[model samples]
Every structure is written in C-alpha cells, then in structure tokens.
Target: MPNPLDPSLATLIERHTGPVKQLRPTEHGRGSDLTALAETEAGAVFVKAMRDRGRAGGRRDSLLREIAVAPHLGGLAPALLWGEADSGWVVGGWEAAEGRPVDLRPGSTDLPAVVDVVRRVGELPLPEVAEDWPEQRWDRFVAPGEEDLFAGRALLYTDWHPHNFLLGPAGCWLVDWSWPTRGAAFISPALLVVELVAAGHQPAAAQGLLADCPAWSGAPAAAVDAFAAAHALMCRSAADRRPQQPWLAAVADAAECWAAHRAEG
Candidate 1:
C-alpha cells in the first residue's frame, strides 16, 4: 500500500487521506519533481515529489495554486483533495479518461474529443495569478507583438497535451497542475496544438482544430507559428536537459514539422 519511493508520504496520507490501497508510477512531465499514482481510502491522487533546486523557491505551493484554481475550473479538471507545499505531494481524485498516450496517434478517435476539450479550455475563465509568481515569456522565438495575445492574471496549467487531459466520467479532466502559470490565453492552446501535432495528428487536422478555436479567430497566424517554433525550442532544450527523454525528442520533431507547415502558408 505504501509507496517505497516516499515512505514518509505514505504515513502522512494515512493521516490525511485514510488507508492506503496501492501506489504505482505514473506519467510525469519534466522540470518537476518525481511523481506517482497513489490510491488511498479517500480516492486516487497524483503524487509529485518536489525537488529542492530549480526555480519558484522550491515548488512555490503548487497544490495551493491548484486548490485556488480547481474550484473555478472544477468541471474542466479533477478535484484536489489535499497537498503539502513543503513536501510537494498534492493529491486529487482520479477520473477515468477515455484516451491514452497512444490515442494521440493518427486515426485515434480521441482527436475529436481532445479538440473539443481544448476548445472548452480556451473558454474557461483565467484564474487569479499571484503577482509574485514567475512570469512566462511569450516572445521566445516568436515576434514581440505576438506576446500580448495570452497575457493575463489568470492561472494556467501551461502543460496542455492529450496526456495531461484525461477522458473521465464527467468529461475531459486535466492533470498535472505542477507547472501552474499565470495568464490562460494563448499559452495553453498553443501547447495543445503543438501536442496534437506531436502525437501524430495530421497537420490539417491540428490546424483545423486551432482555426476553429473561437478565441483564436482574430489571432495572428504569425503568433501561432512563433509559439510553435518556441515550443520546439523549449522541447529541444528540455530534451537536452534530459538526454534520455524520448518523448521530448519526439515532441521536438513534431514541433519542427508544424513550424514548417505554418511557414508554407
């Protein structure tokens, strides 16, 4: 029942989430701490072990951020049960999403559902971002004017891949809120498009999904191209940082393809 990775956390959860049933390793995003799937008396929750180094002053209360934003986007994501900023173990109820990692592959029915979720996410109101939170840059490889399209005080999950979105009982529920960022406008959707392309979705399909986005109607194509380029650079940087990360490399390749396609038009 207790996770060998963090025995102390198992003990803590017994007190917080009731009896523990099982613990298993789960998918995790880079630039964060170790994570796992944990089941307890309360329900299933994601466990993220925080690292001491890196930015945000050691995790910077991610669970707190999720707690703040979850209520607002409750239907869009799972419910947060409890967490500790110092320990970096945030727990939330798990929902069964219809899609899986490979579901992002071509011809996967999950594509339409993913597109729908991305559209819905675009419509969700931005959560209030703390002024002290680290600011996300928009002008990375993209032009400067493209930056303001997504800037706001809203809380954003930043990571918007089909992997992060689970097709649960209610609908698609987003997971891994560890990298909460301010401003929910262009960043998440931009990430989603890049992810869709990376997951083997056709270029036209991915673009159509983005084009259909109501918020992006008046958005500059150059901005999406810039974001796509920037996302590629970021992925490559991440791959470089984690040389063994195959997923990052695949995503980088996809980003390149999307960038080239955008260049043609």
Candidate 2:
C-alpha cells in the first residue's frame, strides 16, 4: 500500500517545504506511522511522521532524539530539514540520501566505506547531548559484580541493523537515528560486528574488520568480552519483548557466538 500522508501533515509539509508536487510513500519499516518520498517545490525530501501520542510517543521521542543528535554527526546521516512537535502530531522532513541498503556479506565492496564511516563516526566525541548512558541500561545484562566498563565519552548509534544504512556514490550514510546510545567508543562498532556476523561473516572475519576502528583497537580485552556477553544477554532479553521474532532470535544467537569467541581470547 502506498503510504498516504495525513492531510494535516501534508499542510505542514507544504508550509515547511513548500508545495508538494507529488508524494510516493516508501515501504513501511519496523517503526513510524509514515515514511514517504515527496516531490516538493524545494525538491525531493524524505519524510517521517509520528502522532506524538500512545505508541507514537516512542517513535516521536526517537525522531526528536535524531533531531538533537544529527548535527553532531557530520555527513554520516541524512539532514533533517524541518520539524514541528506540538498539538497531536510530530513530523520531520529530511534531505533524501538516495541509495540502497548496504550489503555486508563477506567480501562485499561496501565494507570499506562502512568501516571508514564507522571510524569517523566513532571518533566524533560525544557532545553534551541529553542522551541516555548505555551502561546503566545494559546493567541488567552484566554479570553481578563484574567490572563495569560500558561507559565512555563516545556517542554511539546503537542501532546497527542493515536496513539503517544507505550506500551511494558518497559512501555509507547511516540513517534512522532512533536510539542515540552513549557509551564506550568501541561499543557501537562492536555491536555492528555482531550484526555482520548475523549477516553471515565468521566471528574472526568480523573481528578482523573491527581492527580498523581505532576505539576497537584501544578497547581492553576483558572489557570487550564483557560487552559481548552483555550484548548477547540484552539481545536475548529484548527478543522477549517481541516474542516469536525470527530475526531477533538470529541476532541473539550471533551475539552469543561473538561473545563466546571473544571469551576464548
């Protein structure tokens, strides 16, 4: 079904971006009420909308966080153009990063750009954004009394799902800043390596790629192992919230395998 923009939101889109010549809704993803491509007088704009009520609050909060955090991201993310969050709806438009989802299969050409972008992004020092600390949130996954090491000054884009990236002539552009997690600089890339494993890379091969990330190289072995174990537990626990998710199950298993591999070192 073509995503039909709400009439109320269309007015706001035109007001913020000028007259909409046409709108073509993109395939709906895991969250958000609407995702569409609009041909506006201003040009192409990627639009996302949330109602700012009920379940919408989660997506709304996520988008708001993206708005807060995107400026610090340099060119690694799509540009947020305009937004409003009063009344019943929260909507924002972004400069469309025209590209395709990244392919992370072993030996894929996209890996280099992916690593480069990850390095640049991982190097971006965490500014004073009111983001949540990941360590506190992941505490439930840590073994009791184990040394706490998840905290750091690095600003992390915790969601590393394959669909969140776009690869074009400009390289990899990370999109969907739904969960702006703050933690150790190595943690984000570490999380992504688990995703790489899930996408069919051997744990060793995935770990090999992480060496390109400076923070990963600086990470303590024990701390990295602990994080892997903790991530496995977190993935398993989160799967409980979305019972019967096949993808979550696969990621949980992959995370466990990576954790086990790290423990072997």
Candidate 3:
C-alpha cells in the first residue's frame, strides 16, 4: 500500500528527504498506528504516527513518553530524527533499523543478545519525567500487598513480545519504547521470562536467561515472585474482559505458569 501520509505530513517529509520515492507501510504495530518506511536521498527513514498518544496498556500520556524517551536511547533503539503533530495525530521519524523478529524458543542464540539489549537499555539515562513505579501500575492486580518489588530507578520498556524486537546485525535492537515504566532494572528481564513461557519456554529455562544480568541477580526472590503473580492476575483479567482470542488466552496461560513457578520456587 502507498504511504498513508496525508499531504501535510508528506510535504513535511518530502522537504526533509526530497520528493519521496517509495513509501511502504509496516505491519509490525497496531492498526491505529501508522508505521511506514520512506525511501529518501539518505536511505530509509522509519516513521511512526498514531491517531493519538497511547500504547496497549499505558496512560493517555503514552505518546508524550515515547517522544521524550526516543532521543536518549542511542544505539539500543532507533534514533529519532524529527517529530511533529499533524491533524489530530502525533508523528515522528527515526533512523530505520533492519533485522528479523527475535525467535524466543528455548535455546535460541538470540537470547544472549536480547539480554545484552536489556542491560544496555537499563543503563540508558532516565527520561526527565518518570512514569509511576511498575508496582503501582500492577498493584490492583496483585492480591493485596507486595508493592515494593516494583520500585527502582531504572527506565523499563514494559512491553516484551517478539514483534517489538529485531535481532539486528549490531545486536538485538528494540523498536518500541512506547510504554516505558519507571521501575527496578531487572523488571524488564522478569517480564521477558513471562513472554518466554508464552513463546514455549519452561519457566526455569526462561528465567535462566537472566543469570548473567547483574540487576536480575541482585533482585530479591520474593519481590520477583510478587511481580510474576501480579502480571498473571493482570493477564487473566484482560483475557476475561475481551472477546475470546487465542493469543490473549495463551498469554494468560503463560502468565499463570510463571506465577505458579514463582509461587512454587
């Protein structure tokens, strides 16, 4: 399909990269979001435009978070070139990253690279504005107490599905920073463990991926267990409320396994 950019947005890009030659829509994100690759004199520039600012499970200010965090991600994420608001939408252009989606199977080589990315992202400078601590966000889902486990100084990318990653040449380049959470440095890795179960990994095997990360090793066991339980409750609640979709049901099952594994551990 042609680039979905309206004349105003198209004019804006054309002015930057000369008359656009090829515009291709990307299928990696939600339907309401427009991600496209535009061929220009410099090469391919990735563009993301949302009808409004929000991600799958974020506050209404999600668009603001993405815009604020994009500039500081350095090599771990695509660099933002420019951004603007156009006709009820927020749009930005980024240095395009090329790679295949990560395969999160039990013994995939990509695991190590993903771990490296997690550590690097953990090291990135915190955005000026921090979102609420992860514990606060997941608090309602947990049984009653156990909120301290989610508090930390690190910037976290809360969404961890395979589609959000691209195992590129330099390393595993993470594409979406839409739902950054302010929390423990190890939280991202912990979230990855749950996703691994959804992707067919046993809990122990998936948790093993975090062994080398200092943050994950430093986290208290009880706190980690609390996070797993909270995530499980959140996933189950989501599945229950929505139309019966296989992926949601499957994720809920994965969350259950991780939470159960944590409980048993």
Candidate that would win on TM-score: 2
What is the C-alpha lDDT profile of model 1 across 33-110, one tens digit per residue? 455566766566655455433365345456456545656664776655555544535433333234444266777776
State TM-scores per candidate.
0.76, 0.91, 0.89
For residues 64-116, what per-residue lDDT tens digits would candidate 2 score against the true structure?
Answer: 87777777788788888878775567778889887788888998988887788
Q: Candidate 3's residue-wise lDDT over 1-265, tens digit each?
A: 1455567667766655676778988887663366788888679998776664334444325655677778778677878888776555677788888888888888788888877877777677666666553436787866665676677788888788787888777667888777787887778888888888998999998888778877788889988888888888888888888856778888989999999988987
Candidate 2 matches the true fold with a TM-score of: 0.91
Best by lDDT: 2
Which pairs of residues have clashing backbones in candidate 2?
none
Taking every candidate in turn, the Cα RMSD to the unseen true structure, in Å, is: 3.8, 2.4, 2.9
- Residue 132 Cα positional deviation in candidate 1, in Å, after optimal superposition: 5.2
Candidate 1 stretches with Cα past 4 Å from truth are: 1-8, 27-46, 49-55, 58-64, 86-102, 130-150, 153-155, 240-243
Q: In model 3, what is the error at residue 253, expressed in angstroms?
A: 0.7
In model 2, where do residues sit more than 4 Å from their true spots? 1-4, 54-57, 131-135, 145-147, 240-243
Better of 2 and 3 by lDDT: 2
